[model samples]
Structure formats: C-alpha cells, structure tokens
Target: MAARAMHVLTSRVGEHNAVILSQEALSNLVGCSERRLRDAVKLLAAENWIEIRRIGGRGTVNAYVINDRVAWAGARDGRRYSLFSATVIAVDDEQPDANELGQQAPLRQLPTMYPGEGQLPSGEGLDPPSQPSLGGLETDLPARRISPPAGSPFDDEK
Candidate 1:
C-alpha cells in the first residue's frame, strides 16, 4: 500500500520540497484505486513519513511534505500550479525569485521597442501621426480609451 502511494508521491516531488495533487490524480499516478491511494496516504501520515493535507472535498488537491524535517508548509499560492506533475510549489511572497516568475516577471528586460516596432510609451504607434486642432493649430492628441459600463460581466447580481 505504501509502495504504491510512494510511487505517486515521488513523481510529484520537486526541488521546492512540496507536493500538492488531487486525490484522484495521485491514485492514477499510483496505478491504483483512489481508495487504496487514500489508505496509503493515511498510513504514511500516521507513520510520520510524510505530512498530507486535504482540503474540504474529494477533488481538492492534497499537499504533502516528504522531507520529515518540514512538519508544516505554508499554504501554496493558487498561481503555482503544475500540469504534468500535479505539484504546487510553496513560495515565499516576501522574497520572490525573478526566475520563478518567468514571463510574468515584474522586472523583465523590456522587449525591443525600436522606433517602429510597436506602440510607443506614449501610446502612439511608431508612425506618429500629426493632427490639426480646431483653429487650424497642429497638436498631438492623447490616446483615447473607451471603457465599458460600471459593473463588469463577472460581477454578481443584486
């Protein structure tokens, strides 16, 4: 029983030292029924070999700490999801890593914005067009944006 679960656990383990996967996925990785995988998780937790945490329901992913030294791990962030491994990395928001953020990196090297590549910082395209204002005067017009009405489509109904 433990063997099967271990097979599943190790597959999802990573350098971040945390494993978080839904019970169903874990069982699939173990090549056993969900019941058996759950039983194995209980045994491992009871024996102190690992720490498992389950949320409210069955589909919820269970978090694990294989390294016995870590008794508790901070709740993982929702953005840290893994598709193939079913792992959710625990991150320290206080001290963030640029690599970890990747494309979403806050301080990424700005993309090449040559004179005519894309829109300029001022919202004008590389070819800034000149406009004639009301009284035969030439002036630059600021980019105009039109926003939808107050309530967003996602807003709940009253």
Candidate 2:
C-alpha cells in the first residue's frame, strides 16, 4: 500500500509538479486512516525513504519527497529486478515483404521501416499526413490577429 501511494505521488508529478501532499491525501491514496498514514510517513522518514518539509506560518502543512535511492536499493537487495534475453533471427527494411531479405543477417542490423502517409498499397488504413501551419493560423485567415484589451478588474478610475 505504501508503494502504491508512492506510485500515485509520482504519477501526479506530471500534472502538479509543485504539489505538496497533505496527510489526508496520502491517507486516502494508501487506503488507511490519517493517523496510520502519519505513522507510515514517520517510518519512511526514519529510513530516509522520504524527506518531510514544513509549510506555512505555523508549519501546519507537510510535504513528502520520495527517495529513489532507498527504494531502488531495497528492490535490488530483495532480488526483485529481472534480466531478459532474446535472439533476433532476421529482418527486412526496403520491401514490405519480410521474406525479401535472406533469413541470415540478424534482425537488429535491419533499418527500421515506418508507415508513410495515406493508405498502404493493399488499401489498408494508415495515419493521415500532417501539414505544418503558419504560426498555427489557417491559410485563408488574416495574417495579424486582434489582441485582448488590457485592464485588470482592480484597475482604479480617477
């Protein structure tokens, strides 16, 4: 559950990089009570799994900084990491037919082939071609666009 909460925090970094997690947020993420969450956080802090930061005038808020080193070290010590091995037989790049290439050379040496614009030769669907726009403006639209009038809601009238 602690690992799951860490994953959630990591995922949220993309949307809210500056987000500071509240005890309630962490409790909800870990499916535990706020007190339990606080205890878990304390344990993690003692182990250098995370760093706690105090915020605001009275230190009413706290933030957690995940320690990747501790997490990866634990994983490595537990033998949870894996190694995969495989052998490539053959590959073709120029022609769509795989058989065109003699099945001798290793597949890793073959140049990668990607689908181009429009449909394939067999009429199968393909991604449409993308055209670059002139500064994101339509070709038929006016070159210069109008700007919004400048004024704040708090502007003073003398």
lDDT of 1 by residue, 20-91 (tens): 766666666678887888788889888888876654476456777776544434457743333222266343
What TM-score should be assigned to candidate 2? 0.36
Candidate 2, after superposition: displacement of residue 88 in Å?
46
Worst 10-residue stretch by lDDT in candidate 1?
78-87
Model 2: how far is 135 from its true place, Å?
18
Candidate 2 Cα RMSD after full superposition onto the native fold (Å): 22.5
Kindly list the per-residue Cα lDDT of model 2 for residues 64-155, writing each as its tens digit.
55533212223665655422221111223324775655665565333323353232333335532344344656346446754444575554
* Per-model CA lDDT versus the true structure: 0.61, 0.51
Total clashes for model 2: 0
For model 2, where is the 10-residue window of minimal lDDT?
82-91
- TM-score of each model, in listed order: 0.43, 0.36
Candidate number of the best TM-score: 1
